[model samples]
Target: MTILAIGAAGIAAVLLAVWLKGVRAEYAVYLVMAAEILFMLSAAGRLEVILDAMERMRGYIRVDSAYLGTLLKMIGITYVAEFASGICRDAGYGALGNQIQILGKLSVLGVSMPVFLALFETLERFMK
Candidate 1:
């Protein structure tokens, strides 16, 4: 999993460099999405491991469940945004892709409100 992730990052970095060197933005986006897909697929079969790692990190970081939940929500938001944006781009509506991205961000923020409120309530109780 780590290896796949590292390779994906390396490829993305190279693709980004290619774009910076004037290699066409469209190709760069394709390459980035391909890399993301590859890494995501590699991680797909290891969800248990991923969750365990997240839990271990939570323990090490001394973070509450709210923080972990928010992190997960952000991750989900990123995945959905990328998917919708890609679809819109494939359909030849770059403008729609941008709109989808904005909508995704808003939806994630809205969904996270409950968790944030719960966290705030916990903190308030602690303060009292």
Candidate 2:
């Protein structure tokens, strides 16, 4: 979906949620979650294109496939964590949201450990 369309939909959802908050507060949270799911679904289509572009770049750069795969996993973890955390915060669980974010950071760090090790190895070789 185009940015304009997405923006319009987001604004509409927010307005509706604000109105629903007055009538049925719980339903407003549900509505917001539904809107977030729809938005994520729409963005999923574009994610394929991004992945394809990254693959082509990897081929041109001759980088190890494992590194590229790790990068993708890190990116995925970051986005998913942010999405989940946002939902939690919206549902009035700010602490849960913060924890989700921290977990995401740790996950990303864990996933990138191999890359960090490889870099250190390369640097050590140069120093030798």
Best by lDDT: 2
Candidate 1 TM-score, C-alpha based: 0.52
Name the best candidate (by TM-score). 2
For each candidate in the order shown, give its overall lDDT on alpha carbons: 0.75, 0.94
In angstroms, the error of model 1 at 13 is: 15
Candidate 1 stretches with Cα past 4 Å from truth are 1-49, 58-70, 126-128
How displaced is residue 32 in candidate 2, in Å? 0.4
lDDT of 2 by residue, 7-94 (tens): 9999999999999999999999999999899988998778888899988998789899898899999989998999999999999999
Residue 74 alpha-carbon offset, candidate 2, angstroms? 0.3
User: Which parts of model 2 are misplaced by more than 4 Å?
Assistant: none
Error of 2 at 84 (Å): 0.4
Q: How many residue pairs clash in each candidate?
A: 0, 0
RMSD of 2: 0.8
